[model samples]
Target: MTNLIRKLWVPVMTLMAITGMGQMPIFKRYYVADIPGLAWLGEPFTVHWVHYAGAAVLMFMVAVITIRWFADREPLTTSGTLRITLLALLICTGYIRVVKNLPDIHFSPTFTMLIDWTHLLFAMLLGVAALWSARTGRRSYTKQTESLRRI
Candidate 1:
């Protein structure tokens, strides 16, 4: 189960990142809508819904991984600590963005844009961190296997 989750980590993060990018107004107007079949992506609500759904999936995956890590008493390395910090900040910003989107709530345009930009920045950083973690994990696994073969 842990292995499966590890394998899925990168792909899921990539999907979430793409959907998040699609929500950007400029990206939608200049790129997404220009694509023939993907014109539907230009619809703000459609992209928002997809992003929300992806977030739910991501939350679940993170929860499971975190729980398993704690249960197994896994050692947290520096990169692991960084990933956790980024995920926590990302979740907080994402929640704020969703709340600010509600009809009853109104924030200043500047504040809203700040939140959006911060969320996007954290997401991009988190994606890079996840990719780096996966690459390093794979390299270490390969080294372990090679060492075992020689002995």
Candidate 2:
């Protein structure tokens, strides 16, 4: 469990922020719409925000733990780069599995679709970051290894 968290977790707080914000209205106005479940559940938008907030908080905690403690070293170094890439991919997967799948669990069409797109955008950014970080780390490692061999 510790290894899994350390090796394969990067939580995106933006998702949490989006969901939490979406759900806030649900607590107050309840649903103005006639969707049967929406009213009973107290505004799906609110529910979305609440869900997002919870996810955000959980992700934030995990991220801090992984970065501060589990990571073992800074990502700018070669050994740490692999760990960072894995963490980023895991986060991307979570966005697909968690927020993107919320529509199936709830009845908010707009909320569901909107979140999916946002998650996709985040995934793209993560992909780029992972690639760049990994390449830089590899180059640095190669240079160090070559210098040591020459010495």
Error (Å) of candidate 1 at residue 136 is: 5.4
69-146 per-residue lDDT for model 1 (tens digits): 667564566777787889899999999999998999999999999999999889889778877977888322112244
Q: List residue ranges in candidate 1 displaced over 4 A.
A: 132-151
Candidate 1 global CA lDDT score: 0.79
- Candidate achieving the largest TM-score: 1
Tens digits of lDDT, candidate 2, 11-66: 43344444444443543454444465435245565566566556665576566766
Q: How many collisions between residues are there in candidate 2?
A: 7
Clashing residue pairs, backbone N/CA/C < 3 A, model 2: 19-49, 20-49, 20-53, 22-49, 23-46, 23-49, 26-46
TM-score of each: 0.77, 0.31
